[model samples]
Target chain A: AQSVTQLDSQVPVFEEAPVELRCNYSSSVSVYLFWYVQYPNQGLQLLLKYLSGSTLVKGINGFEAEFNKSQTSFHLRKPSVHISDTAEYFCAVQGSNYKLTFGKGTLLTVNP
Target chain B: GAGVSQSPSNKVTEKGKDVELRCDPISGHTALYWYRQSLGQGLEFLIYFQGNSAPDKSGLPSDRFSAERTGGSVSTLTIQRTQQEDSAVYLCASSLGGPSGGYTFGSGTRLTVV
Candidate 1:
């Protein structure tokens, strides 16, 4: 079975500061990685995804994640964040069966 | 039509009662999934339906949880004798039916069991 681990339950950062949300997965075979953001009371929206090719994948809202095959990690990063960026982020992995295994989400609180 | 639609944005029920949640996936989507999100917890896979294949119930937490997708377009998740632990947001998603496809999720139905 596949699983995702999000190291941080919550991350606090000031506006205009950079942020990184850590994620690790356990899978025996190749997998697709994704980062999704959810605003209060809203559905999840794709921030970025690493399907194939480049290890560095850019996504919406100036967010990016690197798929490290060696470490089995897909960490999401943003050079700078705004108060509006405050939301819950989830890291998910898709195995060969197309089922997505999600991490326990990290709440990003961007303070003004 | 444009996005996955779930009914009864919020539902409140008493213990021992049965509740049903509905999901209308995007038109033409062959794959639909149901997931449960407890407070302060990650999304938990409940059930999956792909085309005409037998649904995957491996992730269901208990026998009290049951789900069905009809015509390969709509799905319903029913909880029998709901318990306090059953209170959570139930999310529905759909995709093009492949390992490489990204899913579009609904706002979710919040079920509160009293």
Candidate 2:
């Protein structure tokens, strides 16, 4: 079984400020990590994914995440944030069995 | 033509009524999934269908929830005896299977039980 833990429920940051959303996972088997963002009344959209190879992976909308095998973490980061970046983000892990497990989610609120 | 599509963007039904939500996955997609998202929360997996094989219903919250995929493309999720607690945005996503590519999602159906 695989489980994701997104430590923060909400994060508020000023415009153009760097921010990081923490995520950790627990799995006994090999895992694939992902980050998804959802706007109000919209469906979830994939921000990025970490399948294999390099530990650091870049994603759309100026976002990036690093896969840490030892730490069991895949934290999302952005050099700077804008008002448009305010949304709900979810961290997920797909286990060896192909079941996708998601964390509770973190809400990013960027204020101008 | 390129993305997953969902129908009946909004639905309002009586508490005991049954409702059906539809999803049209991307063309040639072999894996389809259903999920539910309540206000201020993340998505909860409901079921998954891969090709013509049996769907994984392990995430279904109860027997009242059921889903079916025909022609390995479109899928319909039915909720019987809908309750207030059942009101949420039902989301549908499609992927090529495996972990390589990210899943594409539809706009989702907002179900409101009155």
Candidate 3:
């Protein structure tokens, strides 16, 4: 079985400052990693995914995440954050069986 | 549909009242999934329907929870004898399936069992 662990439950950052939300996973086989963001009362939107290319994957709204095979980590990073970027972020891992397991999610609150 | 559509954006039901949530996937999409999101929790996989394959019911938390996708387009999740613990946001998502694209999610139906 595959599982994800989001190290932080909430992260507060000032506008225009950098932020990183940590995520880690555990699986015996190869996996595909994904990041999703959900605004209040809204559905989740895919931020980025790491399939089989470069470790660095970029996605919508100036967000990016790096896949680390050895560390079993895929942490999301934003060079500069905006107030609108505040949302709940989830990290997921799809195993060979095609079951997507998600972490507990990290709430990003960007303050002015 | 242009995007995944879930009806009854919010529902409040008394305990023991059964409720059915609907989900309409984008046109031509083959895979649909159901998930539950409780307060302060992440997405919990509930069920999955992929093409003509048998649905994966491994994630259903209990026998009271069940889902069905008819005509390969619309899905209905039914929670019988609903309990307070069943109160949460039920989300639906669809994808092309098979490692091709990211899933498109609906706004979800926030269910409150009082």
Cα lDDT for residue A101, candidate 1: 94
Residues B1-114, model 2: lDDT tens digits: 589999999999999999999999999889999989887667889999998889999989999999999999999999999999999999999999877887889999999999
Ranking by lDDT: 1, 3, 2
What DockQ, on C-alphas, does every prediction get?
0.79, 0.73, 0.74
Residue pair clashes in candidate 1 = none
Residues A8-68 of candidate 2: C-alpha lDDT, one tens digit per residue: 9999999999999999999988999999998988888999999999999999999999999
Question: Which numbered prediction scores highest in lDDT against the true structure?
Answer: 1
Pitting candidate 1 against candidate 3, the one with the higher DockQ is 1
- Candidate 1 lDDT over residue span B1-114, tens digit each: 999999989999999999999999999989999999998888999899999999999989999999998888889999999999999999999999975659999999999999
Q: If both were scored by lDDT, which would come out higher, candidate 1 or candidate 2?
A: 1
Segments in model 1 whose C-alpha atoms lie over 4 Å from true places: none
Per-residue C-alpha lDDT of model 1 across residues A11-100, encoded as one tens digit per residue: 999999999999999998889999999999998898989999999999999999999999999999999999999999999999889999
- List of chain B TM-scores, one per candidate: 0.97, 0.97, 0.98
lDDT of each: 0.94, 0.93, 0.93
TM-score of each: 0.98, 0.98, 0.98
Lowest lDDT sum, 10 consecutive residues, model 3 chain B, at B95-104
TM-score of 1: 0.98
